[model samples]
Target: MTSASEPDGRRQGASAVADVLKALIREVPDFPEPGIQFKDLTPVLADRHGLAVITAAMAEIAEGADLVAGIDARGFLLGGAVAHRLGIGVLAVRKGGKLPPPVHSETYTLEYGTATLEIPADGIDLAGRRVVIIDDVLATGGTLAAARSLLAASGAEVPAAAVVLELPGLGGREKVAPLQVTSLQTV
Candidate 1:
């Protein structure tokens, strides 16, 4: 149960883990677009120790959540790992058109354009369930914010969100204000 604290008293957890992430996270310039440097977590996720540290930290942040909602792609990996660590089920928030009809969807603006996220409208009882959204990175925050809204509309309570990395200059924190966000590292 390793935990670290931010200057604001928010528990970030395990400086050693942060160090590992910082070391392992690969930075590529001009990815997906010009003037955008991408921080790829593939290496980090592939490393056994890196995965363990992140899973533990994220699980701690999502301690009280009944379910973990992972965003469309990369988030699925972290969400599954954290949910497993916490002994909770994971809800896959899919991309638009990925799931069959009768889906709960929310569209949001991305840095480039726009995208939509969806979850099953039926089969899963979201009413009154507590959820924690997990993702690999928090950039513009459009994806996470839309996921939160989608979950809330379905009657699920989103108490908090966790991510491995946060790009503060993007204003994601301000955009998702009022929702507690825990990030293992900020760049």
Candidate 2:
């Protein structure tokens, strides 16, 4: 339904949307802890244009996915929007113990501590589904990697992951090795 040039045009569009996101992100230094500069995307999501831009761009990247997997909190927001755009469903990948028993969980180490991601082991079978993981940011890639594992365990083929922003030094892209991660913006 589109020409080869369409991909390039889409890339340009995504780049422009990323520019919009960069302006709206709030930089908070040393809030939760020392030596951590948190990139808060609340303001970006709150903006009418920001949300529209990101959702569309991410949806484009999520073209072939049958389902969208939203990691914990923020990913829930992006996943809903992107899935809606794609006319598909969004899976809420929750924090450990949030869901009832019989859940599939993958635990990973974080910079501060350890965390786990869980999904229903039953119901809404994810078997053979092509899923794309959406998250707000990619830091250490621990969370993303865990989510990929959880989904793969559920029999879903996680072909790709997308984030609103990616912190370069964290080696997040490398951490989720071979699983393509598309960061709308990097800072």
Candidate 3:
């Protein structure tokens, strides 16, 4: 049961969170490779207030999700925070070779190369679970698309994905067509 005022409060909170992200997120050019600008969210995640605001906003978007699957590395931080806020479990979608044998995996192409993501096939029961994928940024869409497929192959229903930032120019949205994506901010 929520009051009408609750929505207003959340809206205001989300706006504030967006401001925090925009202020703290760093833009570094020629990172990892030439002619590429990378958006670093490490500062935001390290800030106490920033973490609370972003986590709350992400949790709001993940309301109906039964489970939260976070991409390897940075996604793990955001996913863990959002899952904790929602009182749900956070599944770490690990990088290839990080997990032991008997795992579900998917590989996708990156701008520079190809990478694989994986999850345990034996320990967790993903069948019939409603999941929301969380990540720091949506770039090529390959990572996200692969993650969604991996989840589906394990019998999970991924209704939506939440990201802190999205590079629409990269055509990730189009790449993962049919999958609703919610981005806090676009760059």
TM-score of each: 0.91, 0.91, 0.91
What RMSD, rounded to one decimal, does every model reach? 4.3, 3.5, 3.3
Tens-digit lDDT string for candidate 1 (15-78): 7768889889999999978998899999999988788778878888899899999987888998
lDDT of each: 0.88, 0.87, 0.87
* lDDT digits (tens) for residues 77-124 of candidate 2: 999999998899999999999999899999999877999999988887
Off by over 4 Å in 3: 1-14
Which predicted model would earn the best lDDT? Answer: 1
In candidate 3, list every pair of residues with a backbone clash: none
Candidate 2 runs further than 4 Å off: 1-12
Steric overlap count per candidate:
1, 0, 0
Off by over 4 Å in 1: 1-13
Question: What's the distance in Å from true for residue 45, model 1?
Answer: 0.6
